[model samples]
Target: MAGYVVAAILLFSAVAYFVGRAAGERFVSANGDQVHSLPGYHGAFVAVWVGIPALILVLVWLSAQGSVIDGLVLGGLPADLVAGKTPSEINLLLSEIKNVAAGHIFSEPTPEIVAASQALLRWDEIARWAMVVVVLAMLIGTMFVARLRLAPRFRARTEVERVLSWLMIACAVSAILATLGIIVSLLAESFAFFRMVPLHEFLFGLRWEPQIAIRADQVAGQGAFGAVPVFVGTLVISCIAMAVAVPVGLYTAIYLVEYADERVRNIVKPLLEILAGVPTVVYGFFAVLTVAPAIRQAGSLMGLAISPNSALAAGLVMGVMIIPFISSLADDALRAVPRSMRDGSLAMGATRAETMLKVLLPAALPGIMGGILLALSRAIGETMIVVMAAGLIATLTINPIDSVTTVTVQIVTLLIGDTEFDSPKTLAAFALGLMLFLVTLALNVIALTIVRKYREQYE
Candidate 1:
């Protein structure tokens, strides 16, 4: 059924594209003086029109089909079976019944329940195919009608151009909308988690130990969810990443934008990015193999209990990963600062360093800050380096010598392997993600806000 729907949609879309293109050609020929846009616009516009409605129909039908089918199936069951059950209870029962009907080993089913389930399942499948056919027919009909008056003076060019422009706008909007949807979904799950674990406790708790067992019948320890320790680990690692990224990145930016010859810039820029191109997993292993042991041995001399997977190991590797991002962005931002500013400062008898630091860097501060904010955000959101290199123990201590976990690391640990979706351990990840998103979002917002407010506007 999915195959049939896919084929029908694709076939109709191609037909629509050809029809629209033909219409556009005729319109351009009939009224060349009347046309205000290119010939291709008519065809592309018609193709978009033909595809959008049917595509939306397919998406909508697919999304709701399963739930609607399940509801109707559950509704058809005998009154006595469903009378005492609330809707949620009925949903659970119906789900089990469907599994039983499918001959799944998870549940048992009687003959009568099986018969009703099969009937509803068949009806649902039929309805889906029926909807697909109807949409396909509508698309073909629209295309045929659009192709009818393809004369030169038909205004097809203008119409097609307008539609194409709006289609591009809609595509852009779709990406933005998807991001918003993801944020909302994460926020909702986090809200559910906060209800189970107090917000303050989760925020300030020094230890994190997520528990499993979704139902009351199963028992597990009441674990701590305080994220303060994990948050500290993230802060520590991000600070280290920035520490490495800033000096190297800014200097690279300085050389690239202000001093480097074109040939040198071309050769050096990609080589520097090759460092960024190294897979983070490789960096993780490098940290564990090379950095962690060294740190642990160094700590032993200082009378500290340094774990092999110390924060410094992970942080240093993460910093290496971020340096390219910082340099690339900072270089662009610095270069974007007007050359006129540099000229003015140099004309006033300033040395190269003075001109750069006082004039160019200041004017470019907003852009540079924006780049730092970008690198900072990347550092915080990083998962693999911390997961593989930073040990997954939540501790309140600030010592970089000790092992620590991050929000991302805990999220990975909490959700890794097999998981029961409703378990606190799994939900704990959503809570951590929520915290991470909010922090990153806040940092980005503040960075942009400050840059905008403090942006240089020299007379």
Candidate 2:
């Protein structure tokens, strides 16, 4: 029904646009050279007037309708089920009623539940019908007013541009608000986690066993919130990733920009970028099935012990995954260097290698640093490769061949299954997330400082 209403509104909006455009053309014809806005502008003005208000009406109705129906249905239920129940319990009851109403019954419904489901269905139908009627009326009335107001002097373009500018601002504000909301949520939950587990333990202590007993008398072990091992694992993997990605990606970019013929360059560049398009889960599978086994066998041949699920395998695959980021950014940066500089270096009798090493590289250092930093962040935040290739054990070792878990892996482990949000075990995920956020923020600040310092010199 809502879909039919939207389709109708769209159809009417299209009609209104043509009608308003015709009206504007008529006014221009009648008044000769007195017209201000174009016929298209007048059409757009009519479309905006018709569409915006109707969209708002539909949005408001859709947002409020579900809650209003839920309240009405729950209110009409037996007082005992609605009263003195926890939010989770009430939500579960609502879910069951919804399922039964949708004919997805898991079990026999009580008479009260049956009656409540019937009431819920009836209210939902009535609300949807009301929404359709109200939205259609809004579309028609606004469109009519807009048509009556259309004149050669209406300034439709200005009004349309103003509305569009506000929409852009609203979108920008929404993005900012969403980022702030995430930060605030993480902070609040981390604070709750810290109240249960000390800040120093989370940041400094070496152990990271996050299993907590559900009840005080339960035989399950106590939670240890120390995060040092997780942080170390994350650092080791990111370092390994950067070590592999930076030199290889940077060199690949150099070869493409300086040496390769156009045909080879074009072919190779896209083929390399195809790595970026490959899903991270596919990389994880490749790491687990192929890379990890190869590494283990190689280590055995070298008379060394290497874990089957090791940081080296995950980092190697992750590095391969992020190569395009570094290569693409570095290529752009290197290519951004003036051809004049290269010509001048050659005119000064410098070899290609000398010119590349002394001139182009230094000039593009800031951008290269930016690309490397991005790759590092990608490595740090990755979960799938680490989960598949790196073991769940939170070891403090920095050995790439050792099995270790990262902060992201630990967060996933902690949040799985039925979780009590208030428990330190679950809240620990937020605390880990907060620390990861801070680490990344610090990396960005440092990278910006370095990049800015060098960029000014180069510029």
- Tell me each candidate's TM-score: 0.85, 0.93
Instruction: Give candidate 2's TM-score.
Output: 0.93
lDDT, candidate 2, 1-459, per-residue tens:
878888988998899899889988997899878888889889988998898788778878888889999999988998987888999999999999999999999999999999999998899889888888788788889998999988888898898899999989989999999999999999999999999999998889999888878876777768787899999999999888888998899999999999999999989999999999999999999999999999999999999899989999999999999999999999999999999999999999999999999999999988888988888989999999999999899999999999999999999999997868799999999999999999899889988997999989988
Off by over 4 Å in 2: 1-11, 27-33, 86-89, 102-109, 215-219
- Which candidate's TM-score is highest? 2
* Candidate 1 lDDT score relative to the true structure: 0.80
Cα deviation at 25, candidate 1, in Å, is 3.1
The deviation in Å at residue 374 for candidate 1 is 1.3
- What's the true lDDT of residue 415 in model 1? 79
Root-mean-square deviation per candidate:
3.5, 2.2
In Å, residue 213's CA in model 2 sits off its true spot by 2.7
